[model samples]
Target: MHNAQPWRFRYHRGSRVFEIRADLERAMPHADPDARGLHIGCGAALLNLRVAAVHEGLHPETLLLPDPADRALVASVGLTGAAAADSGLGALYPAIRQRHSSRFPFDDREIPQPLREALGEAARAEGAALTFPSSWHLDEVLELARESEARNMTDPGGDTDLARWTRLDAASADTTDDGVPYDAFGPRKRGGKSPMRDLAGLREVAGRDAADFERNPQLALLSTPRDHPEDWLRAGQAVERVLLLATLEGLSSSLATQPVEWTDLRWALRDPVSGTGHVQLILRLGYGPEGPGTPRRPASDVLEVLP
Candidate 1:
């Protein structure tokens, strides 16, 4: 989440459809120049809406990149069909609020195999691939994250995106409608091998404590068949699906997007065995304290209904 809601929605009352569009003002020109992150985020929102609709006894049919000419129109979701809702999606309604990008360290204890399989299945159901890499592959991905982070910190222009979205003060955290608050920054990594980013970057928080994160983080990669606007949308939906399921399974998670954000390193992160071309997001999952919920704009602020 950023300092502001990155998407807006137009609800077509007559058709019972919600059309999502990117808010360019919230676009990160440096970090997300292509607006890929924006679309992914909206895609996640789309998935949430679907789950909510299912819980309300409706089926949500979504169309990604609904308008070829209007790139800003990311996706459109319409309620279709009657009851007989998707029980699985309806089950995830509670998770939507519980899930957050936990930056805290997880326990050294491993996640159960059954839970891991469930998460992979959730991703597949949304048309994306999630793979838990071997130890060697995990090492490579983490190294790349560190390198990417170093570059982002050292370069003068790299943090423009972060500067706009992160609120460091307690007052701002309490007042802001969006953006990650200081309380949710977790601890400065004094140690451990987790791939969680320091949203604070070089800025030091006076009382923010530091802690040791898990060395062997449960790392998974979400990927797609091809890299395109629609694929990113699908990847976004897949990400939210996996996250909701993980939340329901009593796990907290965070994203390691640095590796995937950098073009050079992202290519290297492909599964050498499968040679998958599209590596979407790096997911770190395990048992940890769930991150605090970041504030979101009320539906009124982000949504408009037309007769």
Candidate 2:
């Protein structure tokens, strides 16, 4: 319900499996025409389903990118006979509804070591890597953010889409209720773009205190071995998995796809020293302020029951 929640599941009572599909109509043409973002978003929903299944006292087995004929159909999750319940997973389910993307400044305090380790464990359970950038690595990421801003500003098509989605006029009821609204946008840095708030390009509309911008926030990167629809979906699942864990641990988080969206800059984000694969998202994780919830379409709008 936070942002894009495009998923249609078919639960087969005979096999005890849940089939997951992508709803393309919910996709963003200009920003994510290829459906990377949509797959990722749907992937997150799939993760929620798995967590819910586990909470019901079942072990879940996932098949990624299961059918080539049905490209939109991402995966099928089957329940194993193991009836053991994971208290760790049970702890996170409560936070799912409470978790929203907070774009505002964090408390500017250091993240504790134990919490960072826990976040990593959460992502690992979903087959992805969540790594924090070192000082030099963080600088590399910021440079890419600058590049992302410049690219968006120069590309009229990209700029137009952003403008249409970012709602700065909090009073404007005419805006689309699906994406980031104006008020939820945080402040802009001295010369940087407004962190690509869900809206296209209204930095001024997305409110923020110039004095509260984060200077040295803890940045985490979510990466997958390959950059495919399945991988994007896996990354998305990992994104929520880690975010939910952070929330339960009393932490706040925000996501930045700016660096990963740019092809050349994205390559630069991979550390030669660490030998990791491509980066899917650049996340800001730490003790900080949480932003308000964005709007979403109803469950009936996105879910379809098929025979």
Candidate 3:
């Protein structure tokens, strides 16, 4: 996950089909040994592609893991005429560019009920459920995040993925077309109760300031009925859907996967009473400064055309 951007596209012009594949070379072996994160990232990209296609008045019929034998082949979308295009998804096209993972402190502003319901519906549309943790569950989730962050800081192997994908210097931030840049890391957590992962753990940046994050952060847990590659893909789509809707609703958002990264903590993240769904992501949403846009590889670099 560390902004590795582990995905690629192969478009067949004649067929008007887009093949989404996992870029295994960019996979985080240490952080995501099972390649689950890779699939989720690919799934998010797939959702974006669908949104773009719909916005351009095209209908996309998506098939996940179409080739079972080819594990890296995450998804394939067959594009057709606009007769069956989804206008709802097309409306989210503008939010695609506006949405960014906000890492800065969010003020203690509560999201309204109707907007929350709309966001939840967005997730459900993609075959996933988004639940705002109860007060008790929120505490537990925050503790798990703290525990995971501590382990990552002390464990020699934990920092391996973060270091590889984080640009601590201005020069690298300017040159690299991927990875989280120092400017996007936001201010250091001087004091707060928000369960934010310190991406810059033990690494200092020249002018990074410190600020107090919100004492009570508005968090939502994204989950599916089961845990599998297909489910991960659905969760990814659901997550992006929620994010885009939130962005359009004037909310800033960030993702916290630190707790979800640890196996035991991940299990504990599930709801205690129902205890059914498998949590795929921990989302933080509120009003705050939107994170600076990180560099993205050019489409030409990630996409391929075949005659």
Candidate 4:
């Protein structure tokens, strides 16, 4: 929900390499000046590509931020070699298509411990950490998020990126194929109590209904060792890993970058007991209505083949 997808790709036919690049032109200057969200989104795409490659009997090896000179170059995924793909990763292929951000209210259902552990392992596999905070800690995190949202919504020029990417206009929604559609808005909050951000951005959703979200929002913080470009990339990959696994396990997830998008709020989001890692993303997982699929620009629009 960080405005919209601000990334592009280049697939070299000759080298059989697929590359991920952060499109600064589409970046949210106000929301993510450091472009951390940009890298995270690209990293998520890289994960999906790897899973798809494994399902198709190919191996995808990644090189994060390969060229330091070109900072926009997020990663290069080499879809080469006939090495046997990891079956476990292939198992998540279906979830790639099934997973979408769910902002709707979720039932008061507790996620099993084993599933939580498994999700933690998934993040660890990508060199990141996902920790579901305790009850009192959750209240703090949600308050931090609320404060951040209040700031973002009120700050001048804060809505710039959101306005650019939200395809709410009737003509825009029908013609162009990118940005969050109105259907994916997940209804207005209507004073509902949840950590989910209202991505609608002041746009009116006709016939939409608002309800009370889960009071005990199942929230988790995805963090990395340090706050660098590479670390951001790792956190992004871990996000996709955990999200795909959650989808497979019948859990719907939403992201609250409101807290993580800001500096002070993000620092407060870290677990007090263990204050080592840099929090990158705030994930909300629960059982709820699946968000409608938003439009995506075709691969041809973003991908280019090298001679």
Candidate 5:
């Protein structure tokens, strides 16, 4: 999460433009070698900015990966003109604050059809696709998820990124405003894996149960046409958009990127005949009781005021 907010925004009072650029220092080599996560993180922030703009009664237009040489510069968002936020957008605004990654077991009830449609619409508006698989497809994907969990758990550095962000104790001096908090993380169910369980927070995050995790949970996927950094960012913005929509519908969701992060596994997800470029993330969603909120770095910390 920390890797994404590297750019600074400047408002040109006359032109009414907001310029987005990459912040190089926040980039992580080990976790995000190619800057995919970095772009995705920025893309999520960009979506937040767009939502905020609509909330303020304006249309936000974004230009992606504008500069060729300046690879760090991801997107430039400009407000087109004065416009009223739509009712649907207004409906989702409230969920921004309420939306969070829920790792605990969902109620086992399927999400309402209307809500699913709304979520799909949210992705379409942002130039991405959000798909909920059939039971058969879900079973296939779940096996991949299990494989991903096992792979990440076995990888030595996989846990490092998570541990860096997760705060085990509220009063602990190592507390960070970013990363998952212990309270928000559910127990690690034996013989099972949840998209929310990153495995790094196991002992630190209280109430992990191995048994409960073995039960199957609903699964979803986020896909994009290309696999470049720009796509990752766009996918991220869509990610935020869909997640917000889910929260508004009174549902919870978690993300699993391990499988998608690996190169070989990613290509396997694409249909050779259809030639879908790549799968950015695998999501788990359902009508679960909400989980606690994880820490978000303050706007002041992430939002840089340009000189």
Candidate 6:
């Protein structure tokens, strides 16, 4: 959940299949005890793989959780013969590298209606629903986020998880291939009620400036019909699709997952009237500075070649 990048990949050349698996060692036991966040992260990677495949004119036939007995096997993607890929997916390929989780302040400007609808469609394409919360819901969600943050400040386990996954110094940020780096932490929040998580927490980061975030951050909730491993995987893909589309539309985005991490807060995040779906993520999006790109492990480290 904290950019742990908890995933591994195995490619079978003979079968032309790519197997996405969970790297349990990187799982956050405290923040993501049930591994739902881990599945979503793996699912996001799967979506990127699909986008890259489609861009190269290869058809990716994906099967989620193909082996019921192997819970770690998140998905299997079979690469078929060259074919006309979905243009929509291919169009998002450029954004794969462009999209970053912006933790900085977003201007108060509202997103256009057409672009918002397109983002919603992107989530639907990956089997999820995206809704901009009503004013009241937004307040509730924000309050839950603050509560989660406060709890994290006091919880030893949460603090440990945060410290383990965040790079506070410039040297580690430059050398480490995983975790949230100092630069990507963005400026410290001086004022405003934006729900952006302060990855640095109580720790101070040198050279980090303070800024006032938007009073009413443009927030969207991504949800699924059910809460299951399958649903989490779908939610991950849906989130990435929405992000890539938003990137293409000149919007900066970041995830606010604090509220969803807690059981009680998660239930309260649901829309009171509909109460039909399970919320998977809280997304903050608006126009401002794009977050710095975080380090990623080399492909050779995460990908394995198999005969």
Say which candidate scores most in TM-score: 3
Cα error, candidate 6, residue 146 (Å): 1.8
lDDT against the true structure, per candidate, is 0.85, 0.73, 0.89, 0.83, 0.70, 0.90
Q: Which residue pairs overlap in candidate 2's backbone?
A: 106-288, 107-288, 162-200, 163-200, 166-199, 167-182
Off by over 4 Å in 6: 84-87
Local accuracy of candidate 3 as per-residue lDDT tens digits, 1-307: 7788899999999999999999999998777888888888998999999999988889999999999999899999989877254458988999988887989999998999999999999999999999998688888988998898888888766678778899999898899999999989988889988887888888788898999999998999999999999999999899998999999999999999888888999999998888788999999999989879778889898999986
Q: Write one digit per residue (lDDT tens) for candidate 6, span 1-307.
A: 7788999999999999999999999999888999999999999999999999998889889999999999899999999977464557888999998987888888899999999999999999999999998678888888898898788777788879888999999888888999998888888889999986788878888888999999988899999999999999999999999999999999999998988989998998887788788999999999998878888889998999999
The superposed Cα distance between candidate 5 and the true structure at residue 218, in angstroms, equals 1.8
Q: Rank the candidates by lDDT, best first.
A: 6, 3, 1, 4, 2, 5
With a 3 Å backbone cut-off (N, CA, C), the pairs that clash in candidate 4 are: none
Structural similarity to truth (TM-score) of each candidate: 0.96, 0.87, 0.98, 0.94, 0.87, 0.97
Clashes of each: 1, 6, 0, 0, 8, 0
Q: Candidate 1: where is the Cα deviation over 4 Å? A: 1-4, 83-87
Tell me which of candidates 1 and 3 scores higher on TM-score. 3
Better of 1 and 6 by TM-score: 6
Tens-digit per-residue lDDT, 34-96, candidate 4: 888888888888888888888888888889989999988889989777647444788899998
Once fitted onto the true fold, the runs of candidate 3 whose alpha carbons sit more than 4 angstroms away are: 83-87
Q: Comparing candidate 2 with candidate 3, which one achieves the higher TM-score?
A: 3
lDDT of 6 at 108: 90
RMSD of each: 1.4, 3.0, 1.1, 1.7, 2.9, 1.2
Against the hidden true structure, what lDDT does model 5 obtain? 0.70
Tell me which residue pairs clash in candidate 5: 6-23, 187-207, 187-208, 188-208, 189-209, 189-210, 190-210, 190-211
Q: Model 1, poorest ten-residue lDDT window?
A: 80-89
